[model samples]
Target: MTQDKHSRRRMLAMVGGALAMPSVLRAQATDPTVVGGTAEARRNISSFRTQRWEDHFDSLGVATLLADTQSRALHYWSADGSDYRLYPTSVPMSEELTKRGYTKVVRKRVGPDWTPTQNMLARDPSLKYMPPGPDNPLGTHALYLDWPAYLIHGTHDTRKIGRRSSSGCIGLYNEKIAELYELAPVGTQVRLI
Candidate 1:
């Protein structure tokens, strides 16, 4: 009977130890790189003064403007802005924007198609692209801001929008961007303040 009790205790100890191993390993496996060892990374994560888009509005042929409150970055588009599109830096179309009276929202797919490549883009370049159509990253409509290689468009990344989410482009809901695109004319000025 004593032998049986000893054996049971040994089994329990082994099981308990096994269960604890994962947590121990996880705690030790934390990457030091994520702690922001580099100066650039530190700057990227630092907080700045809050800014509102409405604060700066120059009616001098100004058509539209996209502003990011978090990053204090602005993307300005003019009737003759360029003929391309201007994307906001790190601003995503968010629910907060909608709740705050932004009736028009655009959603687009601005990520890579392949899973592995997409993951690579997220980790390394921090850049995203809109897919071609409905499944495209640039959702239903894209607000062409007249900037080469930049666009204020809708995104399917509903979660990422409204936050400092994108690499340097402004993101919106697919539907909203389309609506805005229709309303905004070619000469419409966009100011990202």
Candidate 2:
């Protein structure tokens, strides 16, 4: 009877360790300085905290957007400082794919088309131009940044939100992008960190 109890305890211990292994692997794989996917990853990456715009911008000229790639959250403050909003976002999959610095919303587009970047084409030669529609990767609205080929846009793939899924652009949900598109006009100052 004692042997049977020990055997059961050993089995439970092995199962518990097996269940804990993924989290251990994920923690080791995650970079505290960069955003990551999954709820556990979020906890590991700063708990998706909110930040003040003043810390990122000298003034809320027109508007301000701070994309905290580390936390996978976007912070927005209106020009008048009366409105502040935070949204979960999908950041670049890797640090090399991320662009960190200040830029501005130079333009905005509704139902934007998707054209593979030069690097994207080089990687997948089969990639072709995609027109604006459900199949488009840019979703319902797009906020074009001063950096060419980089954007704060919507994605039809809701699964991408809160995950490290984008090639280089920051992605939001379709409805959220539409709302943001209406709020953030041209020349909204943006910083990606």
Tell me, by TM-score, which candidate is best: 2
Per-residue accuracy of model 2 over 29-112 as CA lDDT, tens digit each = 333344365323324433476476877788999999999897888989999999999888999998889999999999999999
lDDT of 2 at 160: 90
Clashes by residue pair, model 2: none
Clashes of each: 48, 0
Rate residue 160 of model 1 by lDDT: 58
Tell me how candidate 1 scores on lDDT: 0.48
Q: lDDT for each of the candidates? A: 0.48, 0.89
Candidate 2 residue spans exceeding 4 A from truth:
1-46
User: In terms of lDDT, which candidate is strongest?
Assistant: 2
lDDT of 2 at 139: 98
TM-score of each: 0.42, 0.77
